[model samples]
Target: MTNAEHISEIATLDNVVSPDKVRLLQLLQTQKAAFLAEPYPSYRSRIDDLKRLKAAILASKETLLSALEKDFHYRSHDESLLGDIFSSLSSIDYATKHLRQWMKPQKRHVGVVFQPAKAEVLYQPRGVVGIISPWNYPVFLTIGPLVAAIAAGNRAMIKVSEFTPHTNTVLRHLLGEVFSQDKVCVVHGETDVAQAFSSLPFDHLLFTGSTQVGRHVMKAASENLVSVTLELGGKSPVIIDNNISLDAAVSRFIYGKTMNAGQTCVAPDYIYCPKNRVDELVDAIKTRYLAMYPSIDGCNKRTRVINHRQYTRLQGYLEEASNLGANVIPLGDVASDETSCFMPLTLITGADQSMAVMREEIFGPILPIVAYDNIEQVIASINENSRPLGLYIQSHDKAFQNKVLRETHAGGVCINDAAFHVVVDDLPFGGIGESGMGSYHGVEGFRTFSHAKSLFKRGRICFSDMLFPPYGKKIHDLFYRFFIR
Candidate 1:
């Protein structure tokens, strides 16, 4: 091949790879090269990155809040501060605090047969991690995994949700302030760019979104055999055991469901309460929720549904449930304002598995309550569906809580509460089965973006030469006879 045709020939190029794909490929190559140049970032360097991340988040706090409001229609500033800003800052602090310990090689026990050799695991950085963050908690989801990637000494490229154009711009600015494009790149476009981005060969890809789209992302990543940590959403259930007070249980789990107006992945999708106490539960929920969200007040501090499409989706859930004979209870003075896209926390009773509300993941402020006769029914009913990202058990009875914990499966469990598990730094936030595949929060987050490479080193003396002969000797026979057992 001469210099003229060294790069490629027009006829030789794959037509399937579009210009958008070409740009993504080039970006991947650039990041991969940068990663190769500094494959393993040192402790000091990673700390510097974390520190810079913290500072940049603080510096861009106002802009981030404004961007979130613009994108979310009317996202609460406090919600953004807690979920997006503070959560990311907390993750950076956690990674910074624990990175030194996490980076240190872990020692492993050596068997008696291999006494002269030492075994350990080195946390190796898998180059060029790709993060596809959702619009719900854009900044946190993007920066959370990025903290892990940086802590693990890996380069990254983030593809934010297209629904969040304003927030995306702010994110690009926030990240740009901290690192160069090669070290940390931010890309955004419609679904086509997202598809092309996922199809790229990455060391690892972390995506936080709906379960349906999660499947597509996983399949696209599989094309390159890329590892993925999908933080997919599903129907997370909240159980109200007889031991706890009705009002108390509502207070704990209702906060989780209504915080992002039930737009949270781990929000309590439905409640499982005693059949006899269903009315009491409803009363408790109404009283508790109305206190927090009195009225629409024209969408002030009220988190509207992200857009009209989601607003209509939530409305459809209510309509279908009502048509199926489920009692739809709208709580606030103004239950919903379509123009504002603000839908108050509504409750559904007599819901069954057949309804779409129960079938799909309701990412809006709709809550469904299912009455059960006993704990067994609740556990059995929950098992019938796919595993969720989070599970909430409200009970003071130790045995009751233990039984629910052992009987059911979820990515994370919140005792007497909900959605708080995912926000914690130490806990591993992920899904099981249909909900999602992998987790990333703190140490788990660090490990998710890292390659745990096992290393074995020999001492001055050699242990293998004794057994490396053409024929088996008496020593080998004795060693095998003794060690085999």
Candidate 2:
């Protein structure tokens, strides 16, 4: 089918709701109750199933890449493969290898007031989970949570981004072939359908998108009081102390800033460097940018702005900053063809906190440089805004790095690195404060989609009879001594 046809199908909400939605909800509820009754899956069988899914994804690599490209006019095939397919496979492998340990019942200590009973924590699957993914990285955003949801033994309904019609269609087709719709379903639609999907009273809801939209999703989920995990975007900051190697710092910063054309949530939105190092860092970044994308004029490998709307928004930001007396430097010359797909990597200096580029999350190939003289000033700057989704600090001094990590609050921190922290399976990836709420990925992801039920198993002894309603002087004395004290 053509892109226009697929988009038309998604835009019309009346035809989007399949009978599968009701069937899947029922099946998921039944399965959840059964799993909770038993509370365990056959270890060997679970491992085998995960392995099968991993292999299936690997085999569909080429198809996934092609669909993603057709959806986004210029998404790099290599980027989709590496950032989405490879990451999803790695998450599944990590969960499979460590499922046994994560599933083990955790023993809890009983307080002195309670005797003849043992307490433990049982991680049981929430009946059904809803995943609302964004178009920027459709595969990873969908499969990343699915890896955790399945590992936790829960059914899921994934709502793919409407912006990526081709990718969404391809994913729905692929997933339908692999798993029964009742076990794993996919929903495709535009904004209205997506809003309805989020409003569904699922056991858990996971949303990845901008903060403004995340708020709407949360408000809708409030109708059912559904627990939600929001992975929203923010203006993540990068601080460079004078102690680091300028060359290494510049390379890492530029690579992360420009990757995926800077559509990443954790992309370094703005940088804070020592006042004296500002010029030096700017020069270094320019040198590294040229080296990376030598001919920015017609570079196909470098990603393009996703759509005209996004392109216009970015252009507005650039124009506004220039009007506000900020120096906007185009990293490389614009292509001769005005309609060229490329957007030159831009660096904006002299930007103040009041500027739109500084206030809003810049999900484009634009980088802003801010200068600070003291550590306290930098920390204050970060604290003044909504806590970012992620924070990056580059300093050779261990004390300074630790101070930044300890004093500042962010969803995640990557010391001496850019966004690499999210890939670690052992670490929880999510935001705090305005950036977002809840964490996921690896064991944390499993827990996010599951509820930790506390179970207390008591022996056949009725030791509590002494404290029954017929309170006597002796019972009151005992209670006072043990409970009050």
Candidate 3:
């Protein structure tokens, strides 16, 4: 699989798209109506749906891995299995095990004055949910949100990115095998279809993509008053503390930067290394990267850019940085055709705010290492920018790590590691500000796709009559004084 092969395949899919938006409308309507019919699914039914989804994913494992490779030219089989397939299965497993407790009504604390009344919150399904998945990890993004929606007992309609048509086909087939169109449906097309899908009146919408496009998705969703959970990307920064081992830091850094060829939303976009340790850190990173993949020329471990358009965008970033006097260092000396899109993992020095690589999210295998004298500068630099989806710190100093963690504001933070915070099902995953808003994963995910309805039950005998309106009695005066404070 190569860039040209992906383009030719996308051309074939382009012919299969509907001539208009009729199918998109039809699918949404069907899902919405089905949701209305089964407004609140039983815990058993939700688990069953999740089970079916898990089974479908396992059944289509090979197809999914192959499609991902075709879509990305050379996506690693291990990456697909761990990132896409395994994550999806784990979500289903977690949901199935905890849904019973999640669906149970939780009791709430009441004031002593309201002893005669009882209160609890009931988790209710939010009806239909719409998910717009990006091309980078098509299956994981789509299925991840779908898992949350299913756990909350809602029907879902997914819109996968156009660049990953092969993976989209497999997803549609696999999901369709488990769920009817009304229960869970996958929509496929280019920009128009995506816009139409986003504009649909879903109960909730979850979009995972770039910050710029996230604005459009949020705007479109707002038209219908649809609550959205945007899992967006930004220039997530990594800090190498002056006290940590360079080898350990660079090893973890290399994993985060090279995974999916740095196409991840939470991938370490840039690194802040000690001013004196820049060369040593860069050398360690290069050594670790090459030791893993000696040659990126035809390595399966090196995932290619999704398409030529993306490849060109990455190349343009490098070219612009080079023109702006950035020191570009390619990690591998792979003698290969540029058309293959196997972008060598490179490090950029002298990268500043003026350069495009530093300002925007570099969704490629390019890591811009900035030299910093102190941790305060790193904290200040992070705060000055829009909040990122993730922040990484390589430090063993408990006090320093705590200080950095307390000072910085990112959707998630990793200590002594990079980009692994998202895999922790116990923690909520999302972003803030330009990175995006709202969170979904674990309990937060269930709540994201659900409506926590507050319930109150009053006893037969109460003090309501004593506090009736039409009098200024001493008791009323006492009550007012007691409550007004």
Best by lDDT: 1
Q: Rank the candidates by lDDT, best first.
A: 1, 3, 2
By the TM-score metric, which is better: model 2 or model 3? 3
Stretches of model 2 off by over 4 angstroms after superposition: 1-45, 333-340, 473-476
What's the TM-score of every candidate structure?
0.96, 0.90, 0.94
Task: Give me the displacement of residue 307 in model 1, in angstroms.
Answer: 0.1
Candidate 1, which segments miss by more than 4 Å at Cα?
Answer: 1-14, 296-298
Superposed Cα deviation of residue 434, candidate 3 (Å): 0.6
- lDDT (10s digit) by residue, model 3, range 328-426: 898777732367787878889998888988888999888999999988888898999899899998889998899988999999999888898887887
Candidate 2 lDDT by residue in tens digits, 275-370: 898888878888888877777435666677777778888888889999999998888645412244457788898999778999999998889999
- In model 1, the clashing pairs are none
Preferred candidate (TM-score higher): 1 or 2? 1
- Per-residue lDDT, model 3, residue 478, is 90
Top-down TM-score ranking: 1, 3, 2
TM-score of 2: 0.90
By TM-score, how accurate is candidate 1?
Answer: 0.96
Scanning candidate 2 in windows of ten residues, the lowest lDDT window is: 2-11
